[model samples]
Target chain A: MNFDDAVRLTEILLGFAFAQQSIEHFKSFPNEQRLFIPRFVLAVLLMIGFQTAWVAGLLFLSGLAMLHRFQGPYNGGSDRMSLLVLFCLCLVYLAPTQRWQEIAFGYLALQLVFSYFFSGWVKIVNPEWRSGRALCDVFQFSVYPASESLRQWSKSPRVLFVMAWGVMVFELIFPLLLLSRISLVIALIVAAGFHFANACLFGLNRFFWIWISAYPSILWFQLRFITAN
Target chain B: MFHILKLLLPAVIPSWRFFDVIAPSPRIQFALLNSANAPSDNDYEWCEFRPRPAHLSFLQMLGRMFWNPERNESLFLVSCAERIVQQPTQHSEDEILKRIIAELKTNHSDSTGETTHLQFRLLLVQRQDSRLQQQVVFHSRIQSLSTQDKT
Candidate 1:
């Protein structure tokens, strides 16, 4: 699909993800009383594909409140990704025309690109990450390790180094892959596998869905900026 | 400019300490031990009421969310524990532990109907070669609970 279609699809998926994460009463009943009502309303609007300015405004606020309510983003990357999508969608609905809406989507794409490059660059500069010890340590001491067998992979220095370097290179080169359709497709596949492994081994299920929701934005960016030419 | 800043600030800011730029060596783990000195694997066990949904299926995302060990409750407690450990002063440690004990007593009293002392401990866990090693870097003195705390 094209950029507009991609934006719409992402909004729908993000709405569902937010709804699932928020359905339970994470805060005490009295504490959540103010947030509970607005959140459900926002979820309903997004689910039904309604993107009015009011809805958007409420969603943007409720997303912030939910993150705050959860004691400031306990889920880490998933929280950040959700906020990015919510903020962009709010802008999309508030924009006066299709052109302006696309601009909002483009901003989301840039943020996603920056997130990948920033995370990878930091890892590259870190001594532990460069030595492959970071990946090994994660597997060994992970609180949510899926099984003992999974953690055993840390035993092999060669495997650890390759996997560590693989992650760093993939993330560092992620933005470059957006310039070509074939390369973007390959990168997307590799990225999906990476998230899948993380979800399975580390139980970071929310990260898997939230990050994938941002993929369409990158795809839209490529279509608008590169493939059209 | 305002709109742009709004979109960028949260994205640029690191939301969770775990997602910090630098992955430190020898990560930390938090554990709660009962007065009997036995460690319970379930963190929620100490909480008076474990949060659950109307239906288990709607709450369980792909049967994985429920099993996620890194629940927000524990993460929040860990953050609090980290702050307490950083000071390493008797007065500060006592203050933090007192606050934590009060929280536990308030939250975990009614449902469990069990009176037990609890201690919060932080473990410095590291991996070397094929083995994982851990030691208690910081541990709170046990906070004993009275039967009267069974609110």
Candidate 2:
């Protein structure tokens, strides 16, 4: 898809994904949930293609309320990234010129790239992460285990070490996703697989949706700035 | 100079870690202590802080949906406990203990009931490689709780 189409696709997909969680949040916290219910409805409208830009703005305000009600990010990384994506989308809608829209998406793309690269660097610096002990430890104490079989694998140090290195290497090289269409496709597929594995094992379901939403922006930035040039 | 400063910003800024890093070895658990310098096992069990009442399943689900259900303000809690441990002057200890107890009371208070004089001990448990090498990082009476609470 082209950049604009990609942007539209991202908005609809994110709207649908967040709507479920938003409704769940509304149901969970009766006292602070009032604002989120309206946000949930607006998100569904955004998905249904009703006054997309205006709905996006309302969604942005409600998103801010949700952030405040939680006193910070409720789910950490995914929440923060989701907020950024909403801001970027609103900016794209507000931009007066095509050049400004391109820049806005490019900024989102930069944040996405930095997130992975920065995370990888942090891991490589830590002794525990470097030793592969971190992954083993997480699997051992994960809240929602995929199965007893998966938990048993945490006992094998060699397997954990290999998996740790694999994750670190892939994340470090994640920026290479911007190289070309073929590379970007492959990188995204691999990243999707990684996110799917996390969701299956640890039930980090929110991460999958937020991270996938950024892929379109990354693709747009690469095509507009690097490939097209 | 500008490029170097730009490069270092992410390293300096704290947000980048973003729960991406996993801690190794011993898993950390926090236990709430009562005003008597003992665990408040009357309502909630002393083993761990699992939210009671089956109807609050949504809250439990919300906890699992985000991060570990057991950890809330965990890093800050540990740091405060450590500060009290490192400097055990009567004044400092009293100040920290007062703060912790006040926080617990506020968090657990029910508006419908009369104010209660609740004194509880906070225990920081770290389970090591196996069941044997566990460490008690913090108990209410840091110096005497293990013996006192046991009895």
| Best-performing candidate as measured by TM-score | 1
Q: Which tens-of-lDDT digit does each residue in A43-131 have in candidate 1?
A: 76776778545666777777666554443454656767777787787788778998998898888888777777777887888888888
What is the RMSD, in Å, between candidate 1 and the native fold over all Cα? Answer: 7.1
Worst 10 residues of 2 chain A by lDDT: A141-150
lDDT (0 to 1) per candidate: 0.63, 0.60
| A28-106: candidate 2 lDDT, tens digit per residue | 3254468767877888888887888999899877766655444345555566777778888888899999899888887
What are the models' TM-scores? 0.71, 0.68
lDDT of 2 by residue, B49-78 (tens): 222222323344345444432222232233
Off by over 4 Å in 1: A24-41, A97-99, B1-8, B12-62, B65-117, B126-151
Expressed as tens digits, the lDDT of each residue in B1-151 for candidate 1 is 3544454476545432333232222223223444556554455243311222223232343466434532433334444445555656554344345545555556655632454665555655555555656665665665665422221
